[model samples]
Target: MRATVDFAPLFRSSVGFDRMLNALDLASRIPTVDNWPPYDIVKTGEDDYRIDMAVAGLAENDLTITQERNTLVVTGRKAQEPQSAAEYLHRGIAGREFERRFDLAEHMKVTDAHFENGLLSITLKREIPEAMKPRRIAITSSTTRAEEAVPQIEARKEAA
Candidate 1:
């Protein structure tokens, strides 16, 4: 079975895009014909994430990774053959040019990236500001005593 996501609603709706959505749309459309490289997105910690992309038969020089605003773009092109000497019997694996993009959340930054064993690993960390962090309020006696206090009523005299 294959998974399919309908983006017609997304196209119809008026959603505010800030650089990220554009890249995401392009990435989703790129895998329409073929999903060549399998990838994985993992949450490592509270604010840390990892994106692993399988890129076999690709060299560091042939691949390029770039980030603009909150979008990460990856492109790769296999080197052309020097000469078509012998005829090929069977060709199963696909080696072609590809471009992929990913939309990143706000405050998320790519800290480290490494490529090993045909896998490109990218680490992301979201750093929250001090003001944005969860704060604990100290319970004091003043607040508690205010709630316990009773209301006082003044007696009124009837006028002739």
Candidate 2:
């Protein structure tokens, strides 16, 4: 059973959450997508994440990772076999072409990707710009301002 959520009310008040809400709605609708290659998303640190995908029978050259805006795309395609006829009795490892996409949050970028022991690990980090980071503004009292004003008043009276 699939549950439907109406986002019309949310869209009325939210300003920049349309993409996130749309992604959730789209994901809920698509319930029959294949999960051939298993993957894991882990939060390694406060602002760091890692995605490990099981890509057996695939080498580094057979995989391609791309990032466009806030989307991360990982694709795998096995090389064509040489001109030789070889029949397998029991084939288990899947080398089929597959493409997986992950929607990343704003300012999140892919740092590195490496394949080891049939596991493709992709590292990501969220790098917020300096201007966007939280800052503390020092508040001054009104009395301190009046005390500093008295000195400037004396200087002006002497000049007059």
Candidate 3:
């Protein structure tokens, strides 16, 4: 007996099938997705997230964080030093330069970011309005409940 894999069901609906194709294309572009400046993504709470990238030896002025067209760009470049009186026998530190980009979701904006202790921390918060938040509708029965159980004629006479 031979095992048969079913993939037709995946293409039956157009919900996220296109996204899967786009992801496949993107995967083919990048040879490796290794985290250069190792980072951590922490989910602080609902609709709140924090991204911490280890960018040591990088000063506040050397790093830049910007949002462009739903993309979070983090770029860092070390300040150049004069080599007139500096000489190194063996240098193995990786403080050269690097740029990292993170794709942001819709309505997901960066609230704040900070650089401290050689770690660049970027905070993101999703602004979901009251209507956008998930709400539980109150189930009602067919019976009508009176507001105060008052007589209609009495209420009309009082208003007059």
Using TM-score as the measure, the top candidate is 2
lDDT score for residue 118 of model 3: 88
| lDDT ranking, best first | 2, 1, 3
Q: What is the lDDT of residue 78 in candidate 1?
A: 87
Per-residue alpha-carbon lDDT of candidate 3 for residues 24-86, written as tens digits (9 for 90 to 100): 556555666556788898999998999999888778999989999678999989999657777
Off by over 4 Å in 2: 150-160
lDDT of 1 by residue, 95-140 (tens): 5789887778877888998999888898999987899889999777
Worst 10 residues of 3 by lDDT: 1-10
Clashing pairs in 1: none
Against the reference, the lDDT scores of all candidates come to: 0.80, 0.92, 0.79
TM-scores, all candidates, are 0.61, 0.87, 0.69
Give per-residue CA lDDT, model 2, range 42-67, as digits (tens).
99999999999999999899999999
Residue 91 shift from truth in candidate 2, angstroms: 1.1
What is the TM-score (0 to 1) of candidate 3? 0.69
lDDT of 3: 0.79
